[model samples]
Target: MSGGLIGLSGLIILFVLLIIRIPVAFAMFAVGFAGIWVLRDLNSAMSLLASESFTIASSAELVVVPLFILMGNVASVTGMSARLYDAAYAIVGQIRGGLALATVLGCAGFAALSGSSVASALTMGKVSMDQMNRFDYDNRLSTGVVAAGGTLGILIPPSTGFVIYAILTQQSIGRLFLAGILPGLLLLSMFMLTVVLLCWLMPGFGPRGPKSTMREKGRKMAGALPVLLVVILTIGGIYGGLFSPVEASAVGAGLVILIGVLEGRLGFARFWEAAKSSIVTSATVMLILISAHLINPFLALTHIPTLIGEYLSALDVAPMVVLGLILLTYLVLGCFLEGFAMLVLTMPIFFPVITQLGMDPIWFGVLVVLTLEMGLISPPVGVNVFVVKSVATDVPLGRIFAGVMPFWIAMLVTLAILVAFPQIALILPNTMIE
Candidate 1:
């Protein structure tokens, strides 16, 4: 069979495997290795697979993955997430829908520590759900906010999404991390606005909590200061040229461990559990990266990206129009696929077209990450929604999905603003030290 035909068939089989509950890494691996073997030879396939796995695993830059994951997990065990939530709640929890807003802020804070959306959602959900429940807040709004806010984990600085994108596109990881800051804060503000607007339209949905004393507020804020300091030092270190992204991850992880020990909240058992969890998450990411490397070569052998690029470039529409269509494809795909899966599956086809059109890669990275954030809260397979459901078992899945609708629209607005002013995503990266 022709290489194009084989590539097409391989892609179909890969998706079929995914739909049948196969892990994405294994599916990509099986299809990729097989495709390369057919197009080239068995020896070439085995050689590429072995080399790619080692190269990805041994790469010094990827140390950020487990380190940052460990930092977040340790923070969670040490009760830093709860302190952050309490601090946000103290600041905003008294207003209508304030608890929800606090939830978004808490998620943003947790996102800074943990780059994984699932971890952010699960951690913040456990921290904030009971408080929202305590105030007789609508379950839909409560669960929805946690699910939606959790997605910020991947758009914020130190995000795994940006790290993966940087590696795939060969862009600077530091610049990508910087590029995410403005867009991340923009989404956070928009999410808060959605909560406010929803409460205005129906105050009963999110009733206000009793105001805290100024002393109480100060205490909670003080309680959260340590983690806040870690966030600032790590991200600020990158922005100030004091640390590379990998270096920043190491420092952040180290500080979190130290704080846990000093506070006596992270026991040997807890620390070991955090390390084990980070290992599992990191291993999964590494396998996916290796599989992606194999698939990239197979796709090149088939000339699939070149074909798609030529076809896209030949269209009569403006480049921005083509970009819009590509994003729309992402929107449609988001409903079914997880964010990382979508990135690896589509970037090989789309990233080339993006560069061919002369768009900035960093801006495109932010845009794509935003779309991935949307997917996390989207229907049919909204991973964050399911995660929220897992934590708030009393709330039905449908309610959680319904609650996230407003925040989803808020994300759409944020995306439009970023597209209209690409500077929003590019400003920090453009000015960063080379």
Candidate 2:
């Protein structure tokens, strides 16, 4: 048959494999290699496989993946994440839904350090769940806050999501990092407002927390000062042109380790565990990226992206309408696929359409990452919801999903605001970078 038909069949088989619970990287590798062999030759397929694997595994840009993950893992092992929560609690825990608000702030802070949504959800859930429970907070609100707030990890600086998008689209990672700041904070504020409205409407959902004395607040803030400083240094260093993204990652990791050791928190055994975990996570990301490389060439050979771009360009609608449709597609697919898998699968097909419309790639990257965050909380395959469930095992799965609905709506609102004013995602990157 035609190349397009072969590509179409391969995609269907890939989706079937995913639905049957095959691992994402493996499924993509299988489909991509087989499609290349069918369209070209076995030797070509083998050559592409070996070369792609090596290229992705040794990529210089990807150094950030392991280092940033190690920083987060070490921070968790050393109780730095807990101290961040304590500082946020000291500031806001006395207000109505205060603990939930603190959880959002803590997630934002930790996201700046970790850049992994699973790590953010897992760490914050462990640190905040019992505290919220102690205050008689509703299980739904407590679990929902952790699940939704954790998404900040991908929108803040040092985000793996932005890194991968940059690699695939050939955009500037530093610009994408800067582009995300305002939008991330906007989403954080929307989450906090959602908590306030929920508590106001349903007073039993989140009760007011006990007040902290000024001295206690000061002590807690002081305890978290190291983490705050690390965040400012790493992200600020990137914006100030003092360090490239790779250097920032290394610096951030070194600083976290130094703090952990000096504070007598991270012992050799714990440090070893964190390093090992970072290696495993980094390996997984590398594999996905390698598989994506195979898939991109296979799709290019089929001319599918060209066809889709032509079809989109022929449409009479405004570019914003097309953008809306594209985002809506992401929202639907997110219910079925993991965020990175979705990014790897769709970027090759959709990114060209974005550029053809004369839109800004950096702004689009921020919007795409934000959509991925929504998918982390969306049902059926809400990865963040499952992460929260693993922490709060006694709570029913449906309840956690239900709790995230309000925050999910809040995300939709934030997405809308960014769409209305593209400057929200562009202002920093525009003025700061060039």
Candidate 3:
């Protein structure tokens, strides 16, 4: 069979497996192994699989993922999230829809340390939900904001998604991390604006409260300063080139533990729980990586990427049109599949089209991360919505989905801006890397 035909067959089998409810990693590995055997040979394919698994697992750069995850877990265990919310609420909790806005801001801060959207949503949900309910904030808006805001975890510095993208595209991890900063902040600003505007336009949806006393505000700020310092020292160290990404993660994890210990938050039992959780999460990610290893090589052996690259170049369509089609594909697939699975399934095919259009890899990485953020909040399979819904049993899935629509639109507009002016995503990396 022709290599291109083999590639097409493999893709069809993959989608079939997914639709049948097969585990994504397993489905990819199974199809990838069979495709490799047909396209190459059994022995060569096994050898390739074994080597790729080790190479990916032992990559020094990949250490950043586990360490960053550990930092997040440690902070959660040590009660950093409450301090963050206290500060956020003191600043924004008096206005109409203020509690909802505080939830967004607090989630963004917590997300910086906790790179998982589910974790940020759950943690901030515990901290802010009651206060929002007390403040008469609409349930749909209150829950939706945290769920949507938590997605900033994947776009901010130290994001696992960015790390995976950097590895897949062979882009500089540091540059990808740098590239996400503005977009992340831009998204945060837009979300806050949405909250304010929504409250202004429909005052019945949100009611204002008396402002916090000066003493209360001062105490909240004081308690939150430690978290700010930790974030500044760790992220600043990386962007400043004082430490590599891996080293920055280590330092961040260590500092979280150090703070926990000094504050008496790191008891023996708590430390063990934190360590075990981190191990479990890290192991889960590694297993997925190992499974994806089998698939990536098989795709290469089938000459799929090159064939698609050639086909895309042959098309007379404008590059921007092709890019729109790819983005639309992500939006459609996102409604049913998790972001990681989506990345594994599509990267082999769409990445070729992207490179064929001569887009900057770093910019493209940010754009992809933003798309995944959308997937986390969109309905049916929206992971963050599920997480929030799990905690708030009264909030129907439909309302949570309804509430996220504005943020989704905001994300689309932000994407359009980045697409029109690549500099939004690329300028920092270009100037800073030199």
Candidate 4:
């Protein structure tokens, strides 16, 4: 059989494995290893597997994964996330649909710290859901807000999605991180506007919340200062050349831990638990990345990327048209695949085509990550929706999906805006990073 045929078969089997509920790491590993063995030799496959695993395991750049995760975990355990939510609430909770707006803001804030959609959704859901419910907010609006807001985790700085995309495409992590800033804030604003519109159209969807006194708002903001400062220092440090991404991760984690200790919010036992959770999450990411490395080589050996690139290049359509088609493909796949899996599985095939068209990889990275966020709320495999459902068990799964639809449309608008004006993603990376 031809190499293409073998690669095609491997992908089919990999999809089958995923459909049957095999873990993503194992599925990719199995398909990649088998494909290599068929095209080359068992020894080659084995050596590649061993070397890739070790390389990914020992990667210095990836150290940010665990450290950043630890910062988020520690923040969650030590009540920093709660305080951040309180601050947002004090500032906006009095307006109509303000609590929902605050949830989105909180999710954005936590996204900066955690950089995981699931973590952002889970943490913000716990922190904001009850508060929204107490204000008699519609479950659909409340659940939808959390689910959609959590997706900001992947688009904001320190995003694992960007890290994986950068590693796969050989782009700069700092540049990708910088590229995400404006777009992330844009999406956050879009979500807030969606909330305002929803409440305007349906007055009962989210009632007006009680206003906070200026002193109360000031006090709440004061309480949230530590988290806000950590967010600023770590992300600002990266943009200002004060620290590399790795060093920023370490600094953020250390600051959060120190603050927790000083406030008597995190004892040794709680810190240990947070660390353990971070290790587990980091391990999962590392495995996916290693498996992705294996799969990239396997696909390369099959010449699949070359073939796809040729096919795309031969098209009579404009580059932007081709780009739109590729993004549409991501949106369709997002319904079925986890964001990172989609990135690893498609980037090798798509990145070559994108570069061939002379498109900017950093901008493409931001667009891809943003599409992945939409998937988090898309039905069937909407991971963030399920995450919100877990937090609000009394709310039916369907309602959460329904709630997220408008926000999903809002995301579509944000995606369109980004597409129309690529500068939203490229400006910071271009002007600030050099």
Show model 4 residue runs off by greater than 4 Å: none
Candidate 3 root-mean-square deviation in Å:
1.7
Q: Candidate 1 lDDT, tens digit per residue, 1-434?
A: 89899989998998899888899899999999999999999999999999998999898989999999999999998999999999999999889999999999999999999998999999999988998899999998999999999999999989999999988988889988989999999999999989999899999999999899999999999999999999999999989989888999999999999999999998999999999999999999999999999998998999888899889988999999999999999999999887888899899899989998999999999999999999999999899999999999988888889999989999999999999999998888887755
- Please give the TM-score that candidate 4 achieves against the real structure: 0.99
Write the residue-wise lDDT of candidate 2 on 307-417 in tens digits: 988897779999999899889999999999989999999998889899999999999999999999999999999999999999999999999999999999999999999
What TM-score, computed on C-alpha atoms, does each candidate reach?
Answer: 0.99, 0.99, 0.95, 0.99
Candidate 3 residues 247-349, lDDT tens each? 9999999998899899898898888888898888787777667777788777777777777667767789899888887889898888878888887667877
lDDT of each: 0.93, 0.95, 0.84, 0.93
Model 1 weakest lDDT span, ten residues long: 425-434
> What are the runs in model 3 whose C-alpha is more than 4 Å off?
1-6
**TM-score result, candidate 3:** 0.95
Cα lDDT for residue 27, candidate 2: 90
